[model samples]
Target chain A: MHLVGLQAENFRNFSTVQLSFAKHTNLITGSNGSGKSNLIELIYYALFSRSFKTSEDMNLLHWKESYLRTQIEFQRDGVDKTVVVSFNSNKEKKVLLNNIPEKFSVLFRESSVIVFSPSTSQLVKGLPSVRRKWLDRILVRVDREFTSILYSYQQTLRNRNALIKRKLIQKEDYDLYDLLTTNLVSLSSLIRKGRQDLIKMINAVISPTVSKMDLPMFSSIELKYYHSRMMEDPSLLAKEEIKRGGTLIGAHLDQIEIFHGDASVRDFSSEGEQKLISFCLKLCEFDLIQVKTKNSPVCLIDDLFSELDEDRAQLLFKYVSSVSQTIFTDLTGRLIEADKVIPLTREENTICLP
Target chain B: MYEFTPSYLKAVEELHQLPGIGPKSAEKLAASFLKMKQEDFHGFVEALQELREKVKQCSRCYNLAESELCLICSDPERDQTKLCVVEESKDLVAIEKTGAYNGLYHVLQGVLKPIEGIQSNKIRLKELFHRLQHESFQEIILATNFNYEGELTAMYIVKELKNSSLTISRLASGLPMGSDIEFADQLTLKNAFRGREKFSEEMI
Candidate 1:
């Protein structure tokens, strides 16, 4: 599957836009405030029916505009398809697939995209919850059951915590508490098993995959999934949880640690190493999605090439171009071997990408 | 503020207090009422007054009714030995429309959402237990929505009835007939995948 064209109206800084992409490497080059990131966000929003840049759809509207619309035309297995997304000031969102109004998941399930931005480095350098969310997003896309299980797990955690907070929970409430506890343990076990299998898959390919791409700085990566102290039996911590007035055990508290040879990447890796690791993880994610869905996801590389040194950037460009259709946004128009270049320049309210 | 008549504005305000009516919808509805004939207007008012004054919950099942026993409970043909428990009267009505279940129903009015301060006692669980103890029922079907809270409530009831000899079952969750696998939502698809049934020639 590949994106062929896009048409956006009253979206971000662009009042109207009609643009198309090459099937292979395409670079969107522009200076600051020229709607490079906005164009990327438009495609992401059209596919996912939500913005990756902002949580609110209102933020994507043009200045003083009442509505915003985007049309994304892509080719899947040599068959042309169109996805249109529109939002109004009333927070009403409408999605059309091939001109037929459909639910958001219809568009979401039709395609897969792997986005790599500078913020993706947070998966390694930030909190454990960020890493957990990253893992969960990939798992949900691959395993349909993971979404419901994870949702049930979170809800069970909240209900259990609420039960713990009840000051009048008598001895009779033990049955309810035990029910919640047993459910929590079983659900956590499922989640931890999914995360472990994914981590194992990534570790099995991280070194060989990056080495093949010639990015040796990240050729020795390993991911370790860690469960909380009470994985099998959360009831062991029931007393402490009640005393703390919240949950103290489950997948919500689980963590994943990344290693580079013998050093912990969370604490010891420099910014460059962290970013490289993030890039390598994105590559593994691309491969995993391809193997699972039998469709190569279009890669949205946002201003990531600019963050790397020129030597690394050149190597990464060669590797990225060989993978699949990739759209890279960069500040400088120095990617000489790109299949197409879109230079975006902005007037007051419109973006001209000629 | 717009110089609408006092009575019209008052009607609009009352309509706006309803669940889904906005200020504009309430105004439109009140204006439509102004366009009605005098007898129709009187009929509408009389119906609203009667609804407020006459409708009472069924004493046995907590369903909205005009008497102590709901129409279903008073009916002699319904399977009295089989009882279906639901979170609301509307669900029972939906099941009745299907003509698939010929049984009595007990409405709990709500489910157990302890996070929102809705405990088991907040609903009709005590009444349901009392009815179960005193009445003879061969089967009890928990027909709650298949969401997390619904499943939790069903589990709670099952745990409470651990020692009871009654046959307890829950509503089956899966894909609807004629559903396309590509467009199915996550939760429905998940339930369908989890509750997949074995295909047999005899069953077919």
Candidate 2:
């Protein structure tokens, strides 16, 4: 499914706005605080029902505005539908699909979108857990069955940690330790293999994309999945964990390593390079989902042009423009071309196509 | 250092014995008890006392109950011949939550924790054995936790019951009730598959 039109009401700097979209690419251009990124976030909220940058839905509401709303229109299976969401004083919200009330989760699988924000730069260089999350979220989205296993594994980790702490406080509580150790070993091992499989799939897509970007001649790009504890027995680790306040030897501590040639890219990669790697990795994920689900996702880019230098800018513009339905934002209006532009004019409280 | 009546001291002592509750919480609870209306404190004591006075472990299954036997065991509609053995009362509750197992259950009450002063005799094992003699059980499926103590307890029971003609089995582990093949840990899955027994008359 692809967005045919988007409207913003009292979100961030936009008081009210409406614009049409192209099936292939739609670029949104405006100045800083012109409500460009806010426009992209609005689209993301409609699709994923989540804010990428902040936890508070109030942040999504326009300043000094207690209520906000968004109306989005898209096409799925050759049928047109509309989804609307309104935020009120109690932070209560309602979702309507094609003018009919619908649950938010039901709206999820029908359409998918990959967001590239400044925060996403951390996917590559921030932490191993971050990269692993990048792996599982896509897997969970396309394959719902994986979500349970992922959740079970997480619960098992928490239970194990609680047992370890209890074991430490009461030296006689070896049974709890044994139980937690066995579980930590069994479930953590499973999570590791899951990560390895995802890493392999991600590499299949990232390898070419990284090669396409062609880093500096001396620089090399590598994405490695590392599971150090997978080789060690979980029970043995549990016995040793008594000394440690927490069990750090399982999937809880599992790290995926990213390298640029001989050096660790997490430490050495430039800011722009981190963004590029993360972008390519996510695009690889975008492709992986398409290959698995046979449906291309809607792509959303928030203030993408400002984050990318001219060289990287052209690459992002070229790539995002190729997606099924893409919406891009920028502080400067002259960047990538969109079939439609909804300018957040200073004079108007709402958005209107410029 | 202040003095307290026996009823007030009981509240402090009970609160202090609970997990994570410190002396501060115990003192707070005692003060709260004082702040409560006399009738309210009496009602709180009655409810707490009822939990201790009324709840009893089933003679057959070790499940907590308001009577001599647990509701599951006392319910005449349940199949007495099929006994599902679990490591603890908690496991029994977990199985009961599914509403899947309609047969009688034998809660070990504890596992074979040799280090914890709990031997096979410490739990309700002897009662379970006696129940087996009186009942014509066709099967005793082990539904223990998927952990070391659980597995060890299961193995001990299976070995002890090997001479009997009754069917003994373990829960399937390949995939949790609702899980996919894609996300399963490779090793856990491999072990699960390896542990899978052939479906046949004797095996069943």
Best by lDDT: 1
Q: Note the residue pairs that clash in candidate 1.
A: none
How many angstroms is residue B123 displaced in model 1 relative to the true structure, after the best TM-score fit? 1.5
Give stretches of model 2 more than 4 Å off. A5-20, A56-73, A79-108, A168-173, A210-220, A230-236, A239-243, A346-349, A352-354, B1-80, B84-138, B141-204
- Candidate 2 TM-score over all chains jointly: 0.66
lDDT of 2 by residue, A90-181 (tens): 78988888788877766766677888778778897787778877777787777655665676666556655655654544433454455545
Overlapping backbone residue pairs in candidate 2 total: 7
What TM-score fits each model? 0.90, 0.66
B-chain TM-score of model 2: 0.80
Model 2's interface RMSD = 8.9
The DockQ scores of all candidates, in the order shown, are 0.50, 0.06
Each model's Cα RMSD = 3.1, 9.6
